[model samples]
Target: MVRWVRALVVGAALAGMITLAGVVLGRIYADPLLVRLVAGAAIGSVGLSVGMRRLPNWTVAPLSATVLGAYTIVGLKLAAGQADVTGPLSQIARDSLVNGIPRLLTAMIPVQPAPDTVVVPVIAAWLAGLAAAEVAVRARRVLLGLLPVVALYAGALYVVGPNASAAGWTTPAFAGLAIVALATSARPAHAEVPEVSAKLRGRAMAGAAAGLVAVIALGAAVGPWVGGQVSASPVDPRRYVQPPQVDSLDESPLNRISGWALSPEQRLFEVSPTGAKSRTVRLRLAVLPDYDGITWRVGATYRNAGRVLPQLPRLPDATTADVRQEIVIDGLTGRLLPVVPTPTEITGARIAFDAATGTLIRPEQLSTGLRYSVVSEVQTPDVNLLPAADVPSGNAVARFLAVGPGVPERIQRLADQLADGNGAAFDRATAIEEFLAEHYRKVADAPSGHAYPNLDFFLFGPRAQGGQVGTSEQFAASFALLARLTGLPSRVVVGFDAPAGGGAVTAGNAIAWPEVLFNDLGWVAFDPMPKSKNPRPVEEDFTPKPTKPPTPPSEPPTSADTSSSSAPPAALAAATDGGPGAAVIAGGASGSVVLLLAGLALALVVMRRGLSRRRLTVGTPDERIGGAWAELRDALRLSGRPLPAHLAATEAAAYAKEPSAVRIRRAAPASEAAPLPPLDELVAGINTVGFAPGAADDAQADRAGSQAVAYATALRARRSWWRRVWWSLHPGPLRWRRPL
Candidate 1:
C-alpha cells in the first residue's frame, strides 16, 4: 500500500508538470484540439509508466514507446480524416516525422491545428511524462525526473519567443508540483523513520524553520529588484532564424500598373463590406521601395502567416478602427494579394505577409472567383500632428532616400526650388503636390514609363519633344523621387481606388500614389494627380482632372543644340551631373569606408581575444595570475568605467561601480544591480598572487584566469544589448595608455 501510494504521488506530480509544459504551446497554436491531445498524451504516458514500474527498466521504455507511437499515429490519422485501416497510415506517419518540425518553426502564430502541427507538441508531452515517470517511480530520483519536464517547458518558451507569455498561475503551479514530488521521494517507500531524542529533533526542526525563513527573506529582498532590472524588450529567437524565401516575390507587381492601365474597362477585383456601414476602401497591392534606374520592386521579406498578423512596434496618435472586407478576385492575375493597409486578420486563403510593408502574397497564383476576408486596422492620423511632423534624417531612412545614378541636375535643382520655403516635411510634401496638380496634365492615354528619362521628359522636356503628359505612374514616381531628394522618406503604392461602399473594382479604378513617412503621422498619402475637368466617360477609364496644358520650354532643342550639350568632356559630365564614372567612384569610396570599419572592428575583437588567451596560457604561473587581473580590468574598461593604475585589485573592483558592473559596494539604491561577492573573492586571489605569494602554481594561475573570465562575463551580460555590441568592438582597452 505504501509503495502504491508513493507511485501515485509521483505519477500525479509528473502528469501535472508535463501537462503544464504542453499547455505553453497555446502561445503558438489556437486550436483546442492541441490542448486536448497534449493532455491525453501526458496522462496516458504517466499512467502507463507508473503501472509498469515493476517490470524491467529496459522493457518499460520499449512498452512506453510502443504505446506513444500507436497513440500519436491514430490521433494524427483520425485528425487527417483517414481513419480507414487500409489507408496510407505508414506514409501519414512518415510525413509527420519528416515535415513536422520544420512546419512548427515556420508556421505563423495561432497556427492552424493540423495533423503535422499537432504531432510535435503531442510527442513532446508524451516523452516528458514518460521519462519523468520512469525516473521518479523506478529510479527513485524525483528531482532528477523534473529535467525532462523543464526541458519541454523551456523549448516551448523559446519557440513561442515574444509571441505570447504563459499565464500567471503556470509558474507557481509547476513549482508547487515539483515541491510535492521532492517531498514524497525524500523517504524510502514503506520505511519508517527512526525516532530521535527530543533535544535533537527540536534542533533539527528549528534549523529547518530557520533555513526556510532565510530563503523567504532573501526572495522578498531581491524579487522586485530582479523584476525591475529585466529588459523591457524580450529577445526574439526567431530573428536569428532566416524567414523562408519565396521566388514569386522577385517579380515586381509594379510592372502590372502599365498593363492594368491599358485595359481600363476590364474587371480586376471586387470588394464587399462585411460590416453594416459602407465606406471607401483603398486597397494596397504592393509597396515599391527599391528602384535601380530600370524598374521598381518590392523590398520586403514575406513569411508564411496565419489569421492573426503580428502587431506593429509603435502605434502613433491616431484613431484606429477595424474594417473588414470580403474580397473576390475577378480578372487580377498575379501572386500578390490586394489588402487594406495594416491587416490584422485574414481568412479563406493561405498567404505570405510582410508586416513592415503591409503587403500580402498568395504563394499560389490568384484565379478568377477566388475569395478572402481581411480585417484591417485603418488609422486616421490626428490632423493637428501633421504640420509639426518632421522627416527622419537621411541616415535613419537611407533606403527610402536612395535614388539611382544619372539623375539630371535640373531635377535636383527643381526639387530644391519647390521645397525651399517649406519648413516642415509635411509642408514640403504638400508643396510638391500643389505644384504638380497646378502645372501638369493627366491624360488617360499617356504612355507608361517611370524611369529617370521618362520623368525628365515629363518635367522639363518641351511638348514638341513628346514631354509633359503621362498617367498616375509618372505623377507618383516623380513625386516619390522628389520627396526623397527633399529629405523625406517615401515609397510608391500601386493599387486601385475602389468605389465607396465596395463593389466591382475595374482596371479603370487602378491608381498609383506616393506616400511620405512623417514622424508622428506615419505614412501620409499625397495627391499629385491633376484634377479632371472632363466628365467621366461611362464604362471607360477614369481620367484625372486636367490642368491647362503645360507651357513649352523657352528654347526647343535642335540637333545642333543636342550636339552642343553632348560636346562636354565625359569627365566634366561625370563631375557635374553624377554620370556613370562618378557613380562607380562614389560606390567604390562607400564600399571602402564600410570595409575599413569592419576591419577595425575585427582587429579589435582579435586583439582582445588574443590578449586574454595569451594571459592564461603563454605566461609564467605568477605572471599568468597577474595577467588574469589585467584581463578583468580590460573587461571593466570595455564598460567605460575607469580603473586607475595606482589602485589595488580590490580597490579597483569596488571603485568600478558604473551601474552595469554589478558593483561590490552598495553605492546605488537597492536594486538588482547590487554588489557581486564573487568579484571580491577573485580580487583576494589577485592580491595574494601580487603581494603574499612567492610563486603561483599552474593550477592557481588557471583558476584565476577562469574566475576572471566568469566575472567579466557577468559584467558584460548586465549591460544593454547595444552597449554589449560596442563593448566587443571597442578598442579602448587595447589602446590603454598604461596597463595596470
Candidate 2:
C-alpha cells in the first residue's frame, strides 16, 4: 500500500510538474500546442523519475539538483529562443574556462526572444547533478548540493537582462561539478566506509583523469565543428524589424475632444476697420461654430451647394484682408459684453444678449478671454461681377478641407444648378455661389435642427420656424453643399475663434469656418454669420506668422561592405549616416577572445600530459615485437578475418612470418644453450615485475621484462611498413590485415 501511495504521489507530482512546465514554456515561447506539450512531457518525466526513485538522501539530492538545474538552464534558453549547442562537452568546458563564468551563465539565462541555439553541456550538467542528488545519503548533503541550484534559479531571472548571456553558465557548472565530486566520493557496494586503495585506486584515478582530459579535448575540437554548422544556416532580417505608426486618439476621450470639438464660445474672430466706418457695416467672416453629428476633416474639395442663377450680377474677384481688434469680456458669465469698437467697421452698435443664458451674441456665442489676429480673403462685388462657365476642379490646398454632415446633397444641388443648360464649368460654379449668397437670409437664430433634404432651414428657421437656433456646423454644411451644387469647389475648416483683449491666443481659443476653392487664388474665406453695425473681425485677434516645415533625418549605412577601405569617403560617409558599428566590433572581439582562451586551454592540457610520469614508462623492443605481432593477429579478426582451426602456436608464428618473428627467432637461445624461457615465464614476469607486482627487488626479471616491452614497441613502430611484405611471404587460414 505504501508503494501504491508512493506511485500515486509520484503521479500527482508529475501532473503538477507537467502543468508547471506547460505554463512556463507557454508563457516563454508561445509555441504551438504540440511543441509545448512535448516540452512539458519531457521536463515532467525527468522530475517524476527522480521523485519516484528510492535512494539515500545524499544520492537523491545530487540527482534532484541535476534535474532541476538542467531544466532551469534549458528553460532559460528555450525562453530566450536560442538553439541548442551541438558541440562536444569538452568544448563547453573550454569556453567556460576562457570566457570566464559570465558567458556560460548568460547562455543559461533565458532571454525574452530566445536565440537559435542552446548550450547542451549546461543541460547535461544540470541533469547529472539532479541524478546524483537523488542517490545522496544525507539530507544535509542533498540540501547543500541544491543550494547552488537554488541560486541558479534566482540567477535565471536576470538571464534576459543585460548580462543574461554572461550569467547562463553559473548554475550548470556549479551543479555539475558538485554532482561529479559527490558521486566520486561515494563508497562502492559492501564497503562500510570510503577507502582509497593506493595501487588500484591510483590506476582508476589515472584512467578517470585521462578520460576527462580526452573528453575536454574532444569537446573543444567538436564544438567548433558544431558551431560551423550553426553558422552555415541563413538568417532573415525582416523577422526582427518593427512596424511604423499607431493612432493616439481612439482610446482617450480627451484626445478625441481635442481633435474634433468646435465650440462657438471659442471665438472665431475680432474685427476693426480703418478710415471713416459707417454706423452699420456688415461684418463678413466664415464661421463653423459647432460640431454636428458628422466630422469635418482638414482637407477635401466639394462642388457648390445651390442653384446657379445667370440673371444675378457677376460675383467679385477673390481678395485677402488682415484685420486686428480687441473686445473686453465679462468673466462672471463667460460672455462678451458690449463695448464701443475703436476704429470699428461700423458705429452705434449694441451687442445682443441671450437673456436665458446671460450670454451676448450677434447670432454666435462668444467665448471669453481670447485674443487673436487673422488674415482672411473676401470676394467683394464690383460692377455686379458676371458668373463664368467652366468651373476650375483641381487644387492642391483642397486636399486639406473636409465636410460635415448633410454636405453631399448641398454639393450635388449646387453643382447641378451651376451646370444648368451651361456645359462650361467655371460659369456654372460662379453662378451657383452668387445665387445662393443673394437668396439665403443670414439669420442669427435658426431652428434647433435643419430640415432633412431641404434648403429652407438657413432661409427660414428659428425666428422663422420657432425652434432653438441651429449651430454653425449645420449652417456651414448647408452653405458649402449648395456652393458645390453650382460647380464651385468648397470645404469646411475647423479651428478656434480668437477674441481680442488677451495678450496672445492659444489652442484653447480655437475656431472653425467654411472655405471655397477659386481658380489661381486657392481657398477663399466667406462668413455667412449675420454681423451687427459695429462688427468684430475674427481673424484680426489671432493671425500668426507662417511656420517653416521640418527637415527629414538622414539614414546611415548598415552593410560592412560599404565601410570597406576601398570605398570612397563620400560613400563611407553616406553609409555611416544611420548609426555607429560598435556592436559589430564588440561581438567580433568577444568571439576572438573566446577562441584564444579555448586554444590556450587545449595547449595547457597537452603540455601537462606530455610532462606526466605515466608517459615515460612505455615498452622496449622485444615486448613491442612479440606483443605487437599478437595484437596484429587480433586486429585481423576485428577486421573480419577468420582464424585457422588446429593451428599450433609455432605454426601460427610461422604463418605470420613477420620481420619481428625473424628477430624473435634470432633472440631465442641456441639448442645447445639453456632452453629459451617459455612464453608463460615471460608473461608472468611482465605481469609481476613491470605491471603489478614490484619489479625493483628482482633485477633479472625487470631486465627481461624491459627487453620484452622494448621489442614489442619497436615491432609496432615498424609493423605498418613491413605488413605487405610479411603477408605476401606467409598467409594463414586468415591473413593479418591492417585496421581500416
Candidate 3:
C-alpha cells in the first residue's frame, strides 16, 4: 500500500512539473499571458500525477487547483483588452451604475464568443489536482513531506505584497496544504516482509522527478506559441471644420428674389397646344415692377397677384384646355430656382430635379442656375360685354388694364376711329389681338437694354427690328402684358413644343404662347409670327438615330500536321493526327480510377499487416515485449502442446510445471528478462546484459545470439502433457508477408 501510494504521488508531481515547464517556455515565445499561465498550471498538475513520486497525495489536489486558478486570472488580465465591448456582459451592464462590470462578466462566461486561452490549461490542472487528492485519500496516506517547503515559499510571497503577489502565493499555499494533509496521513511500514525494494523505489522516485521536469518544460514551451497566433492590432486618431474667408458676398437676401438669368443656352419656356402644329408663336413679353442693376430683381410675394374683384360679377364659364409641357434649362450649376406664372392664380404646377439636389439651392449667386414649370388656361373669348363703371384701386394688373402702354393705346385710338365711341372690354380685347397679329413680324432676335423699354420696341420699333423675333417666351410675355393693358385679361403659358422627329421632346425644346382673357369666354392663344417657306411644326415627334453593330473577325485556317517518323510507330501516328488530345483525356480518366483503387488496396494490406504483427508481439513482460512474444509463440507452437485460447502466460506456465516461471515472477527489473524456454537462465543472462555505458564486443554478440537460439530450441521440445498441449494449441510456422 505504501509503495502504491508513493507511485501515485510521483505520477501527480511529475504531471504538475511538466505543466510548469510548458508555461515558462510558452511565455518566452510571447504566447498570450493567459495561455502561458493556464498551460503552466495544467502541466504542473500532470507532472505531479505522473512524475513526482515523493509528493504527498493531499498536497497535489489543492496545489494543482490553486495554480490553475492563478493561471486563469493572469490569462484574463492579458486578454482583457481584446474583449468585445458589446458582448453579453456589456449588454447586461449597459445601464448599470458601474461601467464595464457587465463586459467583465460576459468575458467570464464560457464558450460564448470563443473559449478563453487559459480555459483548457486551467481546467486540466484543477482536474488533475482533484484526482490526485482523491487517490491519496483512498490510499490512506499521511504526512506529506513537501508541505513545509511549499508553505515557506507561499509565506515569502505574501510578505513581499499580499494583494500584489496574490497569484504567486495562491499556488504555493494550496500545494502546502495538500502536502501537509498527505504527509500527516502517510501509512507506516509493515512489520512483516518489506513491501518495496530500495532499488525499485529509487527508480520510481527518479522517474517521477524526471517527468515533473519534463511537464514544466513542456508548459513553458507551449504557452507562448498559442498566444502569438491569436490576438488584433491597435486605432489612428481628425479636425472638424475649416476657417472662414473675409469679404464674401451676402447671399441671404437673394432667397426672396424670383428673378434669375437665362443664359443664351437656357430654355426660358415651353409651349404645347392640343392639335396645333409646332409653328413659331409670336407673343409679348414683360417683367413685373422691380429695381434693376446689371440684372432685374423680381421679389417673391405672399400676396395673391391675380385675385378677382368682388364688385364685378363672375364672367360666363368657357371650355378651356390644359396643356402639359416640360421645361429644361442648360448652364444651371446650383439646385433651386424660382418659378412664377404670368397673370397668376394658376395652379397645378410641379417641378422636379435630380435626387442629389436637396430642397435648398444655396449660394444664390449668378453661378447657381435655376429652372421651373408653369401651367395656364387658354380659350377663345366672347365678343360682347359692357365696360365697368369704376376700376378697382391697389390692383397693379387693374391699373395696367386701364391705361397701359403699346396695344392699349392703339386699341383705344382704333376704337374711337372705327366706332366713333368708347368700346367695351370684350370688343377692345378682340380688336387688339387682330391688330397685333397683323402688325408684328416673328424673327429670331429682338432689341435689348433700354431700346426695348415697355412694349414700344417690340410693337412700333424700326421695320428691320420689328421683323426680328426673340424667344417664344419674350413673345408670349409681350403679348400677354399688352393684352392686359388694353382691357383684355391675358397671361403667358410656357411649355415644350415637340419637334418633327419621332421621339419625346424634352424641356430643352421649350416654346411659349399667349392666352387672352375675354368676358363671357376665356383665354385664347394666338401666333403673331409671319409665315415662312420651311416652317417646322412644334408638336411633331423626334426619333433618335439607330446605332450600328460591330462586325466579327474571320478565324485563321489550321495548318496541316507534320512530324518525323523516327519515333515509335504509335507515337509517330499520334503526332501526325493532332497529338493525343482525345486519347489523353480518356487515358487520364482511366489512370485516375486505377490510382484510386491501388491506394485503397494498399491501405487494406497495411491494416492486415499491422494486425498480424500485433498478434505476434503478445505475452512478453519486457519493454520490447512485442518482439519476445512473437519468438515465444512460434517456439511453443512447434512443441505440439496447443496453448489454450485467452490464457495468460503465468497461468500457462503454472500448468507447464516449469521451475523457471518462479524466477520470472521474482525478477526485479522486468525490462531485462527474456520470455523463452530455460526462462531462469535466460532471465539471469538478460539481466547481466542490462543497459550500461559500454561498447559491445564481437564475442559478446555471438554468445548472446547462441543463448537466445538454445532457449528457443528448448521451448520447442515436447516433454510433458502440458508442454505438448501448449505446442498443439499454438500455430507452428512463422510466415513473412510483404506490405502491399
Q: TM-scores, in order shown?
A: 0.60, 0.23, 0.24
Give me the candidate number with maximum lDDT: 1
Candidate 1 TM-score over all chains jointly? 0.60
The Cα error of candidate 1 at residue 675, in Å, is: 57
lDDT of each: 0.74, 0.36, 0.37
Query: Could you say which candidate leads in TM-score?
Result: 1
Model 3 weakest 10-residue run by lDDT: 301-310
lDDT of 3 at 160: 25
lDDT tens digits, residues 434-462, model 2? 44444344323333333343334443323
Kindly list the per-residue Cα lDDT of model 1 for residues 256-313, writing each as its tens digit: 6666777889998888854535455688988888876666778777776766687665
Cα TM-score of candidate 2: 0.23
lDDT of 2: 0.36
Which regions of candidate 2 fall more than 4 Å away from where they truly are? Answer: 1-415, 422-426, 437-443, 448-475, 485-487, 492-514, 525-740
